[model samples]
Target: MESSSDTFGKDDSADAKLQESRVVTEEEWLQKWETNNIGFHNEQGHPLLKKYMDIFLDGRSGLKIFFPLCGKTIEMKWLADMGHQVVGVEISESALKDFFTEQKLSFSEEPIPGIPGKLLKSTTGNISLYCCSIFDFTSTITGKFDAIWDRGSLVAVNPCDRERLVTIAEIYALLMLRATLRPPFYVPDSEVKRLFGKSCDITCLEKVDGLAERPKKWGLDYFWEVLYMLVLK
Candidate 1:
């Protein structure tokens, strides 16, 4: 007879395969937010970010930081409090509204030229959020970022969109800046090597265990959270 642990392991493996086989669309993500199925949303800034942000800071002040698929994460507020300009791109208008309202930050909205969405700017103009698809991001519009904090944005995207996501990073990242990326799933080092080998140098790659409390699809008690730092070569 199969033990419960064995059954859970099998279920987890099946769930992983299922996720790999499907493409998650923008509308599906919006629905997830609407239903409050956002297990990914962290009320506090991510622990890893709290620990490692100084590496990105490196004695700099007032650096422009970009968060892709930002999703109203408290990390943006934390970054703003650190004296850096926080720019985020999100697709859900509800999430954007919630971010400002919940933070009690006054903001004004205006349309973004050459894009189909509006830009939400905090009263101090230090935090700017573009409500649009990340693919539509352009330097001409948002300008370049001194640093990028991509907490799970890469892993949250469908496999087909991953390459484009990297391209967008390339276009927006400052020449000497480091882009910090965190993947929610198990991303093997070989896969990371394949993706960023040619154009970027990987400065850090660490697998952080026990970071998530929720059981993974395969019912694992904990999953590895991979942190990667990529610098353009």
Candidate 2:
């Protein structure tokens, strides 16, 4: 496991350049989903998620779990199967619909009161997916959550929007609770601390290289998966 100080040296100019180059837009994401280019979508519900769920969730049951920038990842359904209510906010309606279609789960779609997109819910009512931008998400609509599972949500956003996302998470935490952030790309521990250290306590940081298949599929030399647990203060 590499420490923050070791990962990020004194001069963070390289990190800044990296973030600048990696900035993405909502349209790009929509296009990715439309063309079925979502290499990030793991059907197995993320290896770390299954392995560390008990420890991260701390034996909580029937909790409301929030998934930000959620693609049609089966992880949401897996979480629902764990006796927890899964609430996911996604910008792409196609992705949301695909989730149900792929999983062969029946769901109903209804327009959100003031939000831009509609809400899709499983017939069993254990899973609810809000098809809207994360910016449009408000407490009035989704209410609060006990835990937030941010798999690739942070890394998917434009670098400029990262802080705004953090602000939203802070507000969500005020009413709800803690978060588990897993960025798809490389994000230094120092940067994570800089973003959430004040409002949340950094409980755990672990580095693992479990997704061996992703790097080659995505045309990357290596992919490091970092697990970060943030306990809201």
Top model number, lDDT: 2
Candidate 2 matches the true fold with a TM-score of 0.87
Candidate 2, poorest ten consecutive residues by summed lDDT:
174-183
Tens digit of lDDT per residue, candidate 2, span 31-125? 99999888777877777777777766787788888888888888888888889999999999999999999999999989999868899999999
lDDT of 1 by residue, 121-171 (tens): 999889999999988878899788888888877677776677898788888
RMSD of each: 6.7, 3.1
Runs of candidate 1 with Cα error greater than 4 angstroms are 1-20, 175-186, 216-222
C-alpha lDDT score of every prediction, in listed order: 0.73, 0.74
Error of 1 at 207 (Å): 1.9
**Candidate 1 structure lDDT:** 0.73
